[model samples]
Target chain A: MRAVVTVMLKDGVLDPQGKAIGQALHGLGFPQVGEVRAGKVIELTLDERDPQAARVAAEQMAKKLLANSVIERFEVEIVA
Target chain B: MRAVVTVMLKDGVLDPQGKAIGQALHGLGFPQVGEVRAGKVIELTLDERDPQAARVAAEQMAKKLLANSVIERFEVEIVA
Candidate 1:
């Protein structure tokens, strides 16, 4: 099975990288661009077969290793 | 409107960060973990209201600034 974990900074956190990107976009003639937020996506190939179990395991992985709980939030989606 | 751009390394490209994460997961008792890949997601708040236009603009941003086309590919999705 495959699981995708999306880790994003929590609301109210400052994202310098995102700020830079947004500024760059504006400078590059994309004046319509507004606020930008950047995050990470991790795709995991797992031996687990069951979708429910895979989701649980992936969420655990996100919580334990992939995300910094203090400033980040993560979502896990199971895909075949 | 909001646009989401997901940029990922092309298959066959080496991803040291992902490899390290997989190793850590294995070491941390996730024996079922297999291949791992890491990517990035950028959420852009755009002034454009039309979803189609937002998608096109986001794709252009991905091509021009967000993704390295030689080693990465990007997908753009528009959300209201």
Candidate 2:
């Protein structure tokens, strides 16, 4: 089974990386672009096969180590 | 309108970051985890209303700047 964990900064948190990217896009002529937020995706191929169990396990990982819950939020999605 | 650009490393490319993440997961007791791959997601708020046009523009951004085409592949998704 495969699980995807997406970690993104919390709302109102300052994201310098995202700001830099937004600036870069504007400079590149994508002036229609507005705000940008950068995040990370962790694709895990796990031995677990039960969809519900796999999602629970992946979410645990996201909360425990994959994300800094204080400043970030994570979503776990099961695929395949 | 909103767009998402997901950038992932190509197969056979060495991923030290993914390795480190896997190790950390193992240390945290998620031993069932097999191979882990790390990627990035850039969420953009765009002024464009047409979903197709937004996706095309986002893909261009991904190809030109968001991702390194030599070692990465990017997918652009349009969202409201």
Candidate 3:
């Protein structure tokens, strides 16, 4: 099975890297762009066959190691 | 409007960072985990109101700056 974990900065958290990226994009001529926030996507190809099981496992991975639970939130999607 | 740009490494490209992350996860006792791939997700809050236009604009951003076209493939999703 395949599981995808999307991790993003939690609301109210400061994202300096994301701010820098937004400015970089603007300087690169994408003037129409506004605020740009960045995040991580972790794709896991797991041995688990059940989608529900894979999602649970992936969520655990996200909480334990893939993301900073205090400052980031993660969503898991089962793709296979 | 909001747009999401996901950038991922192309197949066959060496992913040393991802491999290291996987190893770190394994060492952390998450043995059930298998192959893991990492990517970037850029979330843009645009001035444009139309979803299609937001998507198109974000795609251009991905092609020109958000992603390294040579070794990465990007997918754009309009969330607003």
Candidate 4:
């Protein structure tokens, strides 16, 4: 099975990297861009076959290592 | 409007960061994990109201600034 886990900063957390990206986008002529937030997407190929099991495992991985509970949140999606 | 752009290293490209992540996961007892690929997800809030226009603009941003075309591939999804 294949799972995708997306880790994102919690709302109201100061994201300097995102701020920089927003500024860079504006400078690059994308004036329509307003707010920009950057996050991580980790695709994991797992031996688990069951979709529910894969999702649970991915979420466990997210909680244990992929996400910082203090400032970030994560979502896990089983793709295959 | 909200747009999501995912930037990933193309297949066969060396991804040291992803390799490191996979190793770390293995160390953390996720033996079921097989291959791990890491990518970036950028969320952009735009002034454009139309989803199609927002997607186009986001793709332009991805191509021009968000993704390193020589080694990276990008996908844009617009969600208002």
Candidate 5:
């Protein structure tokens, strides 16, 4: 199975990288862009057999490795 | 309107950051994880009045600012 995991800074968390990118975009002439928040995407292939099992494993991966629970939240989606 | 732009390193491009994250996941005992590619997701609010125009503007944003076309590709999706 293939899965996509997205990890993003929680609301109210400071995102310097995102801010820098937004500034760069503005400098590049995208003046209509109001606000920008940056996050991470992880695409992974897993060998888990069952859909439920894959979801469990993917969630575990998010909690244990993919996301920093202190300042981030993650979502996982399986792609067929 | 809101848009999500995903930018990822092209295949065959070296992704040290991705590799490091993969290694960290492995170290955390996710041995079943075969490969990992890290990418960026940018969420933005746009003021464009037309959807088609927003798409065009978003594409230009990807090319000129959000993505390094030399070794990356980007996809933008509008979410309301």
Candidate 6:
């Protein structure tokens, strides 16, 4: 199975990198962009037998290493 | 409309950060992880009228700023 994990900064958390990118985008003429929050996407090919197992494993991976729970939230999607 | 943009490093690109995270995961006991690539996710609340227009705007955003075309690719999903 293939899974994609997206780890994103929680709302209200300060993101300097995202702010910088937003500013750059504004300078480049995309003024409609009001805010930008940057996160991480991790794609994995797993040997899990089912989507439920994949979700559990992915969550474990996120909590254990892929994300900092204090500031980030993660969502998992299983792809065929 | 709300949109999510996920930008990922193309295969064969060196991802030192991902490698470090993978190493940390290994140390933390997730040895099933063979490789890791880290990318970015951006969420936006757009005022676009339709999905097709939103897609065009998003692609322009990705090409102009959100992603580096040389090393990364982006996918956009509209939520409501």
lDDT (Cα, tens digit) per residue for candidate 5, span B1-80: 88889999999999888788778878888877777789999988888888788888888989988899999999989888
Question: Sort by lDDT, best first: what order?
Answer: 1, 2, 4, 5, 3, 6
TM-score of each: 0.99, 0.98, 0.93, 0.98, 0.92, 0.88
- The stretch of ten residues in a row with the least summed lDDT in candidate 3 chain B is B24-33
Worst 10 residues of 4 chain B by lDDT: B15-24
User: What shift in Å separates residue A15 of candidate 1 from its native position after superposition?
Assistant: 0.3
lDDT, candidate 4, at A4: 93
- Give the lDDT of residue B12 in candidate 1: 98
Writing each residue's lDDT as its tens digit, candidate 4 over B1-80 gives: 99999999999999888888889899999999988889999999999989999989999999988999999999998886
As for candidate 3, its clashing pairs are none
Better of 1 and 3 by lDDT: 1
Compute fnat per model. 0.92, 0.93, 0.89, 0.96, 0.89, 0.49
Q: Candidate 4: which stretches are off by over 4 Å?
A: none
Candidate 1 chain A minimal-lDDT segment of 10 residues: A55-64
Quote the chain B TM-score of every prediction.
Answer: 0.97, 0.96, 0.94, 0.96, 0.93, 0.94
lDDT of 4 by residue, A1-80 (tens): 99999999999999998999999999999999999999999989999989999999899899999999999999998996
Query: What TM-score does the A-chain of candidate 1 achieve?
Result: 0.98
Clashing pairs in 6: none
Which tens-of-lDDT digit does each residue in A2-77 have in candidate 5? 7789999999999998898888888988888887899999987777667777778889989988899999999999
Model 1, stretches more than 4 Å misplaced?
A: none
Relative to the true structure, candidate 6 reaches a TM of: 0.88
Tens digits of lDDT, candidate 1, A1-80 = 99999999999999999999999999999999999999999999999979999999998899889999999999998998
Candidates 2 and 3 compared: the better one by DockQ is 2
**What is the i-RMS of every prediction?**
0.5, 0.5, 1.2, 0.6, 1.1, 1.8
Q: Best candidate, lDDT-wise?
A: 1
lDDT of 6 by residue, A1-80 (tens): 77788998998999898888778877887666667778888886666768888788878999887889999998998877
Per-residue lDDT tens digits for candidate 2, residues B1-80, read 99989899998999899999999999999999999999999999999989999988999999889999999998888888
DockQ of each: 0.94, 0.94, 0.81, 0.94, 0.82, 0.59
Model 3 docking grade: high
